[model samples]
Every structure is written in structure tokens, then in C-alpha cells.
Target: MDHNISKHISGNFNQELENVRNHVLAMGGLVEQQLNSALDAVNDSNAELAKKVEHGDYKVNAMEVSIDEECTRIIAKRQPAASDLRLVVAIAKTIADLERIGDEARRIAKVALESTAKDQQGLLGNIDNMGRHVSQMLHDVLDAFARMDAEAAFRVHKEDAKVDREYEALTRQIMTYMMEDPRSIPKVMDLVWSVRSLERIGDRCQNIAEYVIYFVKGKDIRHTSQDDIERDIIGK
Candidate 1:
């Protein structure tokens, strides 16, 4: 009985909405697992683990398609209004972000598979640290979504700043490595893409946080400054 899901006269309608929300959570769980495995693949340089992560992207894509279709059917049949409509819209947007996060994880896994030289692999510093930070942000934002707590969502939104800082530091470190030895460019470039993917995943998590705020407050905060968002929404 999430307050956002209306208690309809028709019990079936209530159940349908609940089922869709549950499906979104299940998909979130799978995507989180995929990301953790991708990190392991990179840290261990296990080609087998990396290949498994790349193969798992299809499952994420399939779930996104299924959830989108279900949301469309709900809109067409239920014609929900107010909070209910917002819930459907939020779920649709959240899944799209989750799918893209999965894509970034797959991209990171590719870095492991592409490394041909041990020395080239050694050119990059430990990415697992930044990977863990983004992973926690994703987990927190999803928790905020499940509870539909706008304040909690805002807290998660703030964490993206730290991820950005980490990405910038890593980029500078990797660039220095390439400059010191231009011969490592080819392998280091793959590492660059992997770190960039990590940053993009942070952005996607922030997008989900905005969707949560939108669903609960009925306010779209996209392209808005963090200071303004707090003053306009959470500070109130």
C-alpha cells in the first residue's frame, strides 16, 4: 500500500499497478548485480567473467522492453490520473536509466577483454574504488525510489558530486600515464572509456533521483541547479 498507488474500486486495477512497481524493483536488482560483476571482471582481469557480464546485457534490455509495454498498457486501459499517472511515468523513466546503467557496466567489462599486455593493464590505477562509490549511489537512489521519499532522493542526488570528482582525478591520473609512455595509448584509451562509463552511470543515477522527486512532489527538476532544487523542493 504505497501511498502513491491509489486504492481503486476495482481490486484488479490496484493489483496491476502493484505488479508493475514490483517488476521495476526486480529489474533494478538485476542491474545492480550486473554492475557488481562487471567491476569484479575488471579488477580480476578475468576474461571469462567479463564475457559473462557482456552476455547479461540482453537480460537487462529484455526487462526494459517488457516493463515499457506493461506501462503503456496500463496507461491505455486504466487512464490513470494525478498521482497514479505520475507513478506510471516515473516507472517508465526509471527503467530507461537502469538500462543505460547496465550498458555502461557492459562497456567497463569490455576493457578487461581488450587488454593484451599485463604492463598495459598495469597502466591504469585501481578503478574498483570509484566503481564502488557509484555502485553505492545507485543502491541508495533505488532505495529512495522504493520508498518514494523525495528527501532521500535528494540526498542521493547530492552524492553525484563526489563521483564526478573521483572521475576527474582518475582521468588526470590516466592521462599522465599515457604522456609518460605514448606507447601505452591503445590500451590506456580503453581504460579511459571505462572510467567515462562509470561517470555516465553516476549521471543516470542522478536522473532516477529526479524522477523520484518528480513523482512525489509533482515537480520536474531536470536541468535545474542543485541549490535551486533544494530551496524549491526539499527545503520547503
Candidate 2:
């Protein structure tokens, strides 16, 4: 949490804001766990675990609603200004992304449940590797948001490109496998969809990182070039 917002403030306004931020972080933690479980289901081919991930999504959804309501209440009652308003707005947007990420995790879990591919060790390994990267990106962005660190957020933004490259590689490999073995098409297609979900998760993480930058600097860097973002963040 950023102490700058709470400093010198009296009464419960700061406390309420802090509570909202904490709830968002808690929601983030749950989503991260859901993502990890979904990946485990893929690597182990455990349908039961995938089912668990699906069921766990309800919790994430509930938290998102709860946090959004709290933010709205704060806005109605307190009408914060400047950085305080930025904090609330950023958190509101972040939870929305988190909810979508949860949805993608559930989709990946469904893929795991449906896949019946044999001799998919190589494909599963690629998915596991991609999962790790996206998972780390999620963790890093959440931390950046909590600390209000724009520089850390920029680092996460850069990592998304690497994830995109890995996703492209996985797609190519899956396509080659499908071409060589028509019988494996069904299973390969499921893996392809699962990787697609993971790639989308990476994209969402990048979105959250951009929100962190916005929260910290009050700049909307969406659709801006990387060079421009670099210059803006570094004050060049």
C-alpha cells in the first residue's frame, strides 16, 4: 500500500480506501492460484483439478463484485480527488481485468478436461512453460500495483512480448503436429485453445501493468509506442 495517500488523513476515509485496495489484492491472489491450478490440470491431465479450478472461479467473481461496490460507495460518500481518485479508478479497472483473467483460466481448465491427447509430452511441456511465464507476469504486475511502482510495471510490459513469441512458437509446433498426424487433430486443437487462453492471460497482465503506470503517473499509455512509454517513464 502507498503511505502517501493515507498520510495526514484523519477519520475513516483512508481506512476505507485501504480496505478496497486490500480486497483487490486478495482477489488477485485467488486468481493467481486459479491460474496455477489450471496449469497443473494441464500438465497432469487431472480432470478433477480442472473441475476444482472451474468451481473456484465463483470466488473470484464474487470478490470482483464486492470490490467494485466498495469503490462505488467510496466515490459516492467521499468524492476523493487527485491521487486518491486515481487509486480507486485504477483498482476498479484492475479488478475487471482480474475477473476476465479468471474466466480465461476457467476456459483453460475446460480445455484440460476435454483433452484426450496421447503422447503429448512435448506440447504439455510447452504449455507448462508458458503458464509459468504468465503466472510470473501476473505476480509481478500485482506487486507493482500494490507498490504503485511504474518502473516495475514497465518491466512487466516488456515481458508480454516474450510471452507472445512463446505463444507463436507453440502455435507453429501444434500446427506442424496436426499436419503430420491427422488422427491427433482433436487433441492438438484443444492444446492450441489452451495455449491461446494462456496467451490472452499474458495480454491481460500487460493491461494491468498499464493500469499500474496510470495509477502512479496519471498517464494513459494505452496504444502508445514502447519507445514513448520508455521516454515518459524515464523522464527523457
Candidate 3:
């Protein structure tokens, strides 16, 4: 193709990219809702709310598959190079992160459904707080992606430590309770799973933030710590 024709095709190719991004955003919205619903279900011991989350997982999975295929098709057809390739690669990775986040949310809902709680107050409250933070982290990471704002992405990365700390505290507390009273063992087991799912969700949020940094600067932030990312490069 001539330069003019190639340019035209590239412009059209952007539409495909935009479509995938939009679909991913839509999936993100649903995942966000699923997290909230899962938290509520756990707090209230509502099997119905958990069921809603279970059903929503199917849609999230389907969206991820559709977006991945579209990105693949666009690249195969356009043969994008340089920054164009970067953007496409970023989209593909972002979709995977979103899908995993959806899976984490599903896991949380499943725990809620299976749990039999003697004390809903502590187990549900701690994990719910963690879930809210993770959800907000994801929201900001997505915003950074849409805006191409590396600084905002860096800020979201710092938030992961808070979630991790909460997860640790919850784990210790739940384990102590189980040890103190063996009868609480059954319920505490489910709480452990609940806390674990929330922690994984936070981890995935961090992954998304790393991707945002990658998308913005073409930098690999995965192996590096938050302090390293901020002080070594993103800060400067």
C-alpha cells in the first residue's frame, strides 16, 4: 500500500483499538460492581447477592475474550509497528489483568456463598474494607490508562501496600481466633479464603497500575518495587 493508503488504514485501525479499549472499560465496570456485590454478600451473608456475582463472571469472561480477539485481528491485519505495536500490546495485557480481576471477584463471591459465619462483624468488615480499597485502586489505574498519566498510575501503586497490610492483619486475626476456639475453625477457614481473595484482588490492582506505567512510558515496571519505580524513574 502507498503511504496515503496505509495512513488511511491506520486511522481505521485506531477505531478497532478504541473499540477494544471501550469493551475493556465496560468489563472493568462490571468487575467493579461484582467486587462491591461480593463484599455486600459476605457482610450480609446473602446468597442471592453472591449468585448475581457468579452470573456476572460469565459476561466479564466473554468481554475479555472478545476484546483479545479484536486486538489480535487488528494487529494481524495492520501489522502495527513501533508505538502502534506498544499500544496494542498494552491493550492485550490490560485485558488479561482485567480478566484476572474478574476471576478474583468471582472467587470472593464463591467464598461468600460457601461461608457459614458465627461472627459476621469482623470477618466481613475487614475484607470489605480491603475490597473497597482494591476497587478504588483499579478505578484509578483505569483512569491513568485512559489519560496516559504515569504519575497517577504511580500513586495507585503505593496504595497496594495498604491493602496488603490489611490482608495480613485480617489473616493473623482470623487465624488467632481459630486457634483460640477450634469450633470457629470451620467458619474461619472460609474467612481465610475470603481474605485471600481480597488480597489477590489488591495484587491484580497493582498489576494494572504497572501496566499503566508501561503503557505510558514503554517501561517494564513489573519486577521493580513501588519505591524503585517512583524514585528511580517515574519520579524523575
Could you estimate the TM-score for every candidate?
0.93, 0.94, 0.90
Off by over 4 Å in 3: 1-12
Clashes of each: 0, 0, 0
* Cα TM-score of candidate 1: 0.93
Q: Over 4 Å off in model 2, which ranges?
A: 4-12
Per-residue lDDT of 99-216 in model 2, one digit per residue for the tens? 9999999988887787566678888898899999999999999888888778889999989999999999999999998899999997778888889999999999999999888877
> On residues 9-35, what C-alpha lDDT tens digit does candidate 1 reach at each position?
245578887888889999999899889
**Location of the lowest summed lDDT over 10 successive residues in candidate 2:** 1-10
Tens digits of lDDT, candidate 3, 1-236? 22322332356576676666677778788888888888788777789989999999999889888888988898888888765677678778888888888887777887767756556576667777777888788888877766657788788888888988998898888888888889878767877887888788778877777776776667888888767888876866
Give Cα-based local distance difference scores for all models: 0.87, 0.88, 0.78
**Model 2 C-alpha RMSD to native:** 1.8
- Of 1 and 3, the candidate ahead on TM-score is 1
Would you give me the overall lDDT of model 1?
0.87
Model 3 worst lDDT run, 10 consecutive residues? 1-10
Model 1 stretches astray by more than 4 angstroms = 4-12, 116-125
The residue pairs in collision within model 1 are none
